[model samples]
Target: MSEPIRVVVTGAAGQIAYSLLYIIANGEVFGKDQKLVLTLLDIPPMMGVLEGVVMELHDCAFPLLTEVIPTADPAVAFKDVSAAFLVGAMPRREGMERKDLLSANVKIFKVQGEALNNHAKKDVKVLVVGNPANTNALICSHFAPSIPKENFTAMTRLDQNRARAQIAQRLGTDISNVKNLIIWGNHSATQYPDAANGTANGKPVTDLVEASYLQSDFVTTVQKRGAAVIAARKMSSAMSAAKAAADHIRDWWHGTESGRFVSMGVVSDGSYGIPKDIVFSFPVEIKNKQWKIVQGLKLDSFARSKLDITTKELLEEKEEAMAVCNGN
Candidate 1:
């Protein structure tokens, strides 16, 4: 077997980590034969919990998992790492302002970003999964100036999956039949779940579903699915989020197959008039181990308006982070 690829995951003791570790250990994310050295990182206080999790990982006895190291130091965790999952962050408290939340996460991401630049492998691919993921990814990418901007991304696959599932249910079809769904712009509520390009067994989704419902109710449901899950389970989503993260990395490193595209929040290259440097989700086709924005799709007035709104929100987030850093 070839030497294992090293992967670093922050928030090692968090619920999402609990769901992610086992899958990664079994080579579900990388590939069945690919080996991995997993570094689990957390704050000092959570080290004991992380260690316990590491013990469970050992119990699984996955042959592809070469090693599991739990640490509190970013530099130690990221050392020679090939891929990074930035899952740790200060979530918004009950009454925290947006600026306060941004300030708190900036501190965490800044440290991790610097560690990535100083210690991680030359080809580190980073996925920011924590809340406010796009901006958080942008911060990390900015700090690691040497790393290609395209290597940094944030998760929107969850939203894409949610949209697919919702469309499947509404059309009374199996989820497997759904394809070409896209979640554009921010991963937040303003995200545009475009059914315009979606297909259910080779037919346009809009052709089979009510256009009004698709434009209004379906869009709302997809964007609000996270909150609905939290309300239904009485806890934040972990397993599904972890699965989505895994799917993201899997598709990214392996490649997306023909006739399918996934949504990922990558650093924009001024596509569709979105500002450069703002990380926004787009319909993307991944091949040759890289993502290319799907171009030449004509958006109707509704889709265009929704995309504009979400892209504007992402820009505002970038501005807010910049202002906080500037103490404005």
Candidate 2:
């Protein structure tokens, strides 16, 4: 067997990590043949909770899971890891403003970024699953100067999965039939769930679904699905979020199929008129653990307007996050 792959998950005691850890341990993200050393990180007060999580991991007796290291230290958690899920961040309180939430998360990500730069392996793949994730990813990448920008990404996969599911539901087809659906810009309400170029089982999705529904309900529904879940369950989404995170890392670690693309929030290189350096969601193809943004998809006026709104929102978010990160 090859050397064990070191994987780290922050917020290990949280519900999302509860679901995510088992998935990783069972070799759902990485291959079943590959051995893994799992590091579970949380706050000092949550160390007790993390211990329980570690116990559960051991109880699972996964053949691929070689070791479990639970700690509160980012330095310890990040050390020489090949893959990292940055799932920990301050949650938005009932009365907190968006700026306040961004400020809190920026502080957390900045420290993690420094830890990644100092302790993690040079080739570590970092996924920021925390809220304000796109901007948080940008902040994390900012402080991790030694790590390549391409190594860091934010989770827009959940948004992509939601969009695809809605498309499948509308067409009365299996979710597997939805292809090339992408979430553009931020992972927030302003995101564009572009189905214009998508297909359902090789048939054009737009041709199957009414444009009126796509223009109204379909777009709005996916954008606000998280809120709806919270409203219905009295808590935020956990299972679906964890599953999407798993699919994301799995696809990235392996590769996407030919002519198939998925949404990932990556640092922009000015593709499709999006401003450079912002972590924006774009349709991308993955191979060799690298993502290339899909290009030349014609965006009509409506799509362009939707993209601009989300782009503007992300720019505003970046401004706020950077100010807090710089201690302004």
Candidate 3:
């Protein structure tokens, strides 16, 4: 067996990590053969809660899990870890302004980024799951000067999975049959769920669904599904988000099959005319743990308009995040 690799999850006592930790420890990700040391990090106040989580992890007796560490220190949690799920952040309280929320998260990510840079393995892969995730990822990448920009990414797979499920439901087919669905730009409501090139069992989704529905209802549904979930459940999504995070890291670690396009929030290299340096969701193919944006898909005028809207929103977010960084 290979040496045990360390993995860390910030906000480990939270609802999403509650589900995600089991998925990782059960060897659903990193393969059944791989050994792992799981590190769980939460704020000081949550340390007692984290100890309970650690106790539960021990109760599971996962063969692949070699050890578990629960802590409130970023240095200890990040030390030599190969991968990190940055799930902790300041939640937007009621009546909080957008700028204030961004500012608060910027501070959190900046400190964590420095911790990652100083303590984590050089090849560490970091996923920012916190809100305003795209910009948080950007700020994290900025502080981690030693790590490659590609190593830092935000979670947008939840949005992609939601879009795929909606399309599959509409067409009355298995969700597994949906392929090549792209989520463009920000992970927020401004995201563009592009179904033009998507397929269900080798049939174009556009051909199977009405154009009017795809243009109006399908787009709006995917964009607003998070809000809809909160209205119904009175809590933000947890299980699905955790599942998406697992799917994302699994595909990224194991590599995607030929012709599969998974959506990820990666650093934009001006792909499809998106501004450089912002984290944007693009349909990408992965191999050897590296992601390359899917190219040459023709975009209609309507798609272009949607893309522009999201791009504008991301640029605004970047400005607000940067202002906080500069002030501090």
lDDT string for model 2 (1-328, tens) is 6789899999999999999998999989999888999998899999888888989999999999999999989999999999999999999899999999998898899889999999999999999999989999999999999999998999999999999999888778999889999899998999999899999989988899998988889899999999999999999999999999998899999999999999999999999999999999999999999989999998999999999999999999999988897883
Candidate 3 colliding pairs:
none
Which runs in model 1 stand beyond 4 Å of their true positions?
none
Residue 224 shift from truth in candidate 3, angstroms: 0.9
| Each model's backbone clash number | 0, 0, 0
Candidate 1, residues 1-328, lDDT tens digits: the string is: 7789999999999999999988888889988888999999999999889889998999999999988989998889999998998889998878998778888888888888889999998788899999899999988887788788899999999999989988888878999899989988998999999989889988998899989998899999988988898899988889989999998999999999897999999999988878888999998999877899999877999998998899888888888887765662
Please provide TM-scores, in order, for all candidate models, with all chains considered together: 0.98, 0.99, 0.99
Question: What ordering of candidates by TM-score runs from best to worst?
Answer: 3, 2, 1
Error of 1 at 187 (Å): 0.9
Q: List the lowest-lDDT window of 10 residues for candidate 1.
A: 319-328
**Candidate 2 overall lDDT versus native:** 0.93
Determine which window of 10 residues in candidate 3 has minimal summed lDDT. Answer: 85-94
lDDT of each: 0.90, 0.93, 0.93
RMSD of each: 1.2, 0.9, 0.7
The C-alpha stretches of model 2 lying farther than 4 A from their native spots are: none
State in Å the error of residue 289, model 1.
1.1
